[model samples]
Target: MRSSYLQTDLLSEFDRLQQQVASLFGGFPSSIRSDRYGSFPKLNVGTTDDAIEIVAFVPGVKSDQIDVSIDKGLLTISGERQALFANEESDDARRYAQERYAGSFRRTIELPANANPEQVTARCSNGCLMVTVAKHEASKPRAITVQ
Candidate 1:
């Protein structure tokens, strides 16, 4: 029937449009996810009146194993995580399922223009790696004097 033919054509057109839209978004990851979803450590970036705070959740990694560096306004955090079952190295003892991520990973964050890398400091405690970048003297908010 003529009506059935038009409906089929319309459905096919919608399917094609959907495929095109999905393809367009396929190249970009969602905001909540990264390119390598399980590779990099999760991070929280915030700011205070005095400094910018970057906290990286790095459980199971020793403080000495973690490295933090700032170069050209890019802050980098690199470290390694050991496997949960290193002693079970045999094929028969292989884990049927493992969700934990274990390996070397590196994450880089872009610091704001107000960030002063020279006054940066890093500390790791309670499985959190906190990096603080002081704000430039001129960047801090100032109250104007009223005559």
Candidate 2:
């Protein structure tokens, strides 16, 4: 009877370890199934002497479908990239997976205190969205002569 009890306990421990492994990786199938698609767009932000530059990799999305705005030092990039599957009414789900972040995306980036939001400019080229936020005059570096 003790040997049977030990075997049962060992099995339970193995099951628990399997669950821990799955959760450590990326959770279970149920968790993945409940996850949502079309997350907010990602960006690469940097700065220069004259302007703060932000580039977002958003391929397969047209320039007309995107909207860029700035409010209270927050720059927002929003867009939608429709799926390009050829099937008009095919019943097959997972048609090309549609994983290119389709159906709307929004990303807000905080601008520095010296950012000149009024002078911001945005352009999309070659599947990348580039935004230039001009820096305030006071923020630009200047040489000073020491007395």
Candidate 3:
């Protein structure tokens, strides 16, 4: 019986430690993820020969609501997602699960050294914000002929 009790205690301690580690990294795992979980509007960054592209998936947000800016090698995206049921009858309604994040959110990304902050452009369509930053002329690759 004493051995069984020790085993139980050890199991509980292990479970607690697991919880702590998970929280330290981020909240409970979910289908949706981000650079920092719970941060609105997940984005993907990629580079091409002449430009860097950033696409932010911001569903349920309007193009007018979003604000994109670049300053000192940092690109920032800010916007708001209004609640879906803000005007609905809430007194009698109950929420079973709430996963969608609403309200204002902002995400800042550091531009690469080759990025040309002066040549940034952004457009929003189909619930996604696409930003393209041209690469500096000095950093662009060039083909050299064999001597």
lDDT of candidate 3 over 1-147, digit per residue (tens): 999999999999999999999899775655543234447888899999999999999999999999999998999999888888863335566766556777789999999999999898899899899999999999999998999
Q: What shift in Å separates residue 113 of candidate 3 from its native position after superposition?
A: 0.6
Task: Return the clash pairs for model 2, or none.
Answer: none
Q: Write the per-residue lDDT of candidate 2 for residues 68-140, one digit (tens) a residue.
A: 9999989989977776764533566555543344566888989999999889899999999999999999999
Kindly state the number of residue pairs that clash in model 1: 0
TM-score of each: 0.73, 0.68, 0.77
**Model 3: residues >4 Å from true position, as ranges?**
1-17, 30-37, 87-93
Rank the models by lDDT, top first. 3, 1, 2
Query: Rank by TM-score, descending?
Result: 3, 1, 2
Worst 10 residues of 2 by lDDT: 31-40
Cα distance off (Å), candidate 3, residue 34: 10
Q: Which ten residues in a row have the lowest lDDT in candidate 3?
A: 29-38
Which ranges in model 2 have alpha carbons more than 4 Å from their true place? 1-40, 86-98
Residues 1-147, candidate 1, lDDT per residue (tens digit)?
999999999999998998888688664443443343454688999999999999999988999999899999899999888877765444566576544577788999999999999998999999999999999999999999999
